[model samples]
Target: MLVDSHCHLDFPDFENERDEVVARAGEAGVGLLVTIATRVRKFPVVCAIAERYDNVWCTVGTHPHNAAEESDVTAEELVNLSEHPKVVGIGEAGLDYFYDRAPRDLQARSFRTHIEAARRTGLPLVIHARDADDDVAAILREEAGRGAFPFILHCFSSGPALARTGVELGGYISFSGILTFKKSDALREIAKGIPHDRLLVETDAPYLAPVPFRGKRNEPAYVAHTAAVLAETIGLSPEETAAITSENFFRLFKKVQRPSMRSA
Candidate 1:
C-alpha cells in the first residue's frame, strides 16, 4: 500500500468530487492520506475531512504564503489543536521567498512557532520551503540546538545544500510529482543519494501532477506515478519503493497508526 503524505483534499479543486477522488486513491493503492492545513482559521474544515475518512488524517498550522494573516498564531495554539486525535502533524509551514506572499520575517516567525509546537507536541513538522533554503537550513539548525524535533521537507525542490542539511539533521525528505518532470534530472540525482530510511514520496495533490498526467489536476491516486519514477531513480522496484516510503511516512508521523495490509 502507498500513502499520499501530503495533499489538500479540502481545497475547492476536489469540492464536487471529493468522494470519487478518495475512492480512486484507494483503487490506486493509496491507503492513507494526510490533507495539510493552509490556514489555521480554516482548520475546522480540514479536520472535518479527516474526521469523515478513517484513513485520512490532518495537520494544524498555516502555510508560509498565508503567514501574514496568521502571524499571531501561537505555539500553544498549535499544540492545543494538535491534541485532537485526528491531527497528526504540526505544519506545512516555512519560508516561501519565491512568492513573497507574506513578508519574509513574518514567515520565519510563523515557521519558528510551528517548530516550537512540533518540539512540544512531538509531532512531525511538514515544511514548505521555496527560494529560502539558506534561511530554512540556518533556522532548523539553530532550533535543533535548543531541542530537536522531527520534520519533513515536504515537496522538496531546493538545492543540494539544503537537502544535505535536512538529512544530516535526521529529517525526512519527501519528493512530489515534480521529481518526475522531464527537466528534473538534477532533482533525480539528489534523490539517488538519500538514505532509503530518510526518503519519502508524495503527490502534493491538486498541484504538481506527474509526467504522464502533467497539466492535469492531481490527486492522491497519482502518487503511484511519482513513486514509480522514484523507484527507477533509486534502483528499487515500484513495490519496494512504495513500501519504503510508506514505512518512512509512519516513522515520521508517529501519531498515525500503521494500517494492516493483507497479502495478495
Candidate 2:
C-alpha cells in the first residue's frame, strides 16, 4: 500500500470528481491520503472530505500564503481542533519566499506557531518550504533547540543544504510529482543521499502531476508515479519504495492508524 502524504483534496479542482479520484487512488494501490488544510477558517471543508472517506485523513493550520489572514489562529486552537479523530497532523505551513504573498516575518511567526502545535499535539507537521530554505532551516534548528517536534518538508524543491538540515533534525522529506521531471536530476541526486527511512512520497495533487501526467490535474493515484521515480533514483524496486515510504509515513504521523492495523 502507498500513502500520498500531502494533497489538497478540498480544493474545488476535485469537487466534482472527488469520489472518483479517491476510488482511483485505491485502484492504483494508494491505500491512504492526507487532504491538507490551507486555511484554518475553512477546516470544516477539509475535515469533511477526510470524514467522508475511511482511507482519508487531514491536517489543520494555515498555509504560508494565507498566514497573515489566519495569523490570529493560535497554537492552542490548532491543538484543540486536532483532537478530531480524522485530523492527524498539523500545518501545510512554512515560509514561502517564492510567492511572498504574506510578509516573511508573518510567515516565520506562523511557522513557529505551527511547530509549537506539533510539539503540543505530537502530530507531524506538513511543512511547505519554497525559496526560503535558509529561514526555514534556521527556524527549524532554533525550534529544535527549544524542543523537538515531528515534521516533513512537503513537496520538497529546495537545496541539498536544506535537505541535509531537515534530515539531521530528524524530519522526513516527501517528494512530489516534481521528482519525475526530466530536469530534476539534482533533486534525484539529493534523494539518493537521503536515508531511506527518512524518505517519503506525495503527489501534491490537483497541482504538480508526475511526468506522464505533468500537464494535467494530479491526484493521489499519481503518487505511484512519483514513487516509481523515487525508486529509480534510489535504486530500489517499486514495491520496496512503497513499503519504505509507507513505513516512514506511519512513523512520522503516528496519529494516523495504519489501514491494515485498524480494527474491523
Candidate 3:
C-alpha cells in the first residue's frame, strides 16, 4: 500500500467526480490519500473530502500562494484546527520564489506560523519549497533552533544541498512524480542518495502528473509510478520501495492514524 502524502482534492478540478477519483486511487493500490489545505479558509472543502473517504486524511495550513490572504492567521488557529482526528499534518507551507504569487514577507510569516503549530502539536510540517532554496533553508535552520520538531519537504525539487540540510535536521524528503521525468536527472541523483528512513513519495496531484501521463490530470493513484521510479533510482524492488517509504511516512507524519488492515 502507498500513501499520497500531498494533494489538493478540494480544488474544483475534482468537484465533478471526486468520488470516482477516490475510488480510482483505491483501485490503484493507494491506501491513504492526504488532501492538503492550500487555503485555511477552504478547510471545510478539504475536511469534507477526507470525511467522505475512510482512507483519506487532511491537513490545515495556508499555502505560499495564499499566504498573503491569510497573513493574519495565527499558530493557535492552526494548532486548534489540527486537533481533529482527520487532520494529521501542519502545512503545504514554505517559500515559492518561482511565482512570487504571494508577497515574500507574507509567505515567510505564514510559514513560521505553520512551523510554530507543528512545534506546538508535535506533528510533522508539510513543506512546499520552490526556487527559494537559500531563504527557505536559512529560515528552516533558524526556526529549527526554537524547538525540536519534524517536517518534510514534500514534492521536493530542490538541490542536494537543501536535501542534505533537510535530512540532516531530522526531516524527511518526499519525491513526487517529477522524479520520473526524463529531464529530471538531477532530481534522480538526489533521490539516489536519500537515506531509507528519510525518503517518502507523493503525486502532488492533480498537478505534475508523472511521465507516461504527463499531459493528463493526476490523482493519488499515480503515486505508484513515482514509487517505481524511486525504486529504480535506489536499486530496490517496487514492493520494497513502497514498504520503505511507507515506514518513513509513518515515522515522519506521526499524527496520521494507521488505518486498520481492512481499510488499507
Candidate 4:
C-alpha cells in the first residue's frame, strides 16, 4: 500500500472532483492521504476535507509563503488544533527563498513556532524548504537542540547539505512528483543515499505531477508514478518502495491510524 504523505485536497483544483480524485488514489493502491494546511485561519476547510474522507488525514499550521499573514498564530494554537482525531501532523511549513512570498525573518519565526508544536504534540512536522537551505538547516539544528522532534522534509528538492542535515537529525525525506522529472538526476542521487526507513513519497498535488502525468493536474493517484521513479533511483521494485514508504509514513506520523490494505 502507498501513502501520499503531503497534498492539498482543499485546493480549488480538486473542487468538483474531490471524490473522484480520492477514489482514483485508492484504485492506484494509495491507502492513505494526508492533505496539508497552508493557512491556520483557513484550517477548517482543510479539516473538513479530512473529516469527510475516512482514509484521509490532515495537519494544522501555516506554510512559509503565508507566514507574514499568519505571523500571529501561536505555537499553542497549533498544538490545540492538532488535537483533532483526523489531524495527524503539524505543518507544511518552513522557508521558501525562491518565492520570497513572505519575509525571510517571518518565515523563520513561523517555522520555529510549528517546530515547538511538533515537539509538544509528538506529531511529525511536515516541512517545506525551498532555496533557503542554510536558514532551514540552521533553524532545524538549533530547535532540535532544545529537544528532539520528529519532522519530514516534504517535497525535497533542495541541496544535498540540507538532506544530509535532516537525515542526521533522524528526520524523514519525502519526495514528490518532481522526482520523476527528467532533469532531476542530481536529486535522484541524493535520494539514493537516504536510509530506506527514512524515505517517503508524496504528490504535493494540484501541482508538480510526475512524468507520464507531467503537465497534467496532479492528484494523489499520481504518487505511484513518483514512487515508481523513486524506486528505480533507489534500486527497489515499485511494490517494495510502496511498502517501505508507507511504513515510514506511519512511523513518523504516529497520530494517523494505519489503514487496512486489503485492496492494496
Q: Please, what are the lDDT tens digits per residue for candidate 2 over residues 176-246?
A: 99999999999999999999999999999899999999999999999999999999999999999999999
Q: Estimate each model's TM-score.
A: 0.98, 0.99, 0.97, 0.98
Best-to-worst lDDT order = 1, 2, 4, 3
Best-fitting candidate, measured by TM-score? 2
lDDT of each: 0.95, 0.95, 0.90, 0.94
How high a TM-score does candidate 3 get?
A: 0.97
Model 1: per-residue Cα lDDT over 1-264, one tens digit each: 999999999999999999999999999999999999999999999999999998899999999999999998999999999999999999989999998999999999999999999999999999999999999999999999999999999999999999999999989999999999999999999999999999998889899999899999999999999999999999999999998999999989999977753222
Q: C-alpha displacement of 134 in model 4, angstroms?
A: 0.7
Query: Candidate 4's C-alpha lDDT?
Result: 0.94
Query: Which scores better on TM-score, 2 or 3?
Result: 2
TM-score of candidate 4 against the unseen true structure: 0.98
Q: Per-residue lDDT for 158-225 in model 3, tens only?
A: 99989998988889999988999999999999998889889999999999999889979988899999
- Candidate 2 lands at a TM-score of 0.99
Off by over 4 Å in 2: none
Q: Ten-residue segment with the worst summed lDDT in candidate 4?
A: 255-264
With a 3 Å backbone cut-off (N, CA, C), the pairs that clash in candidate 4 are: none
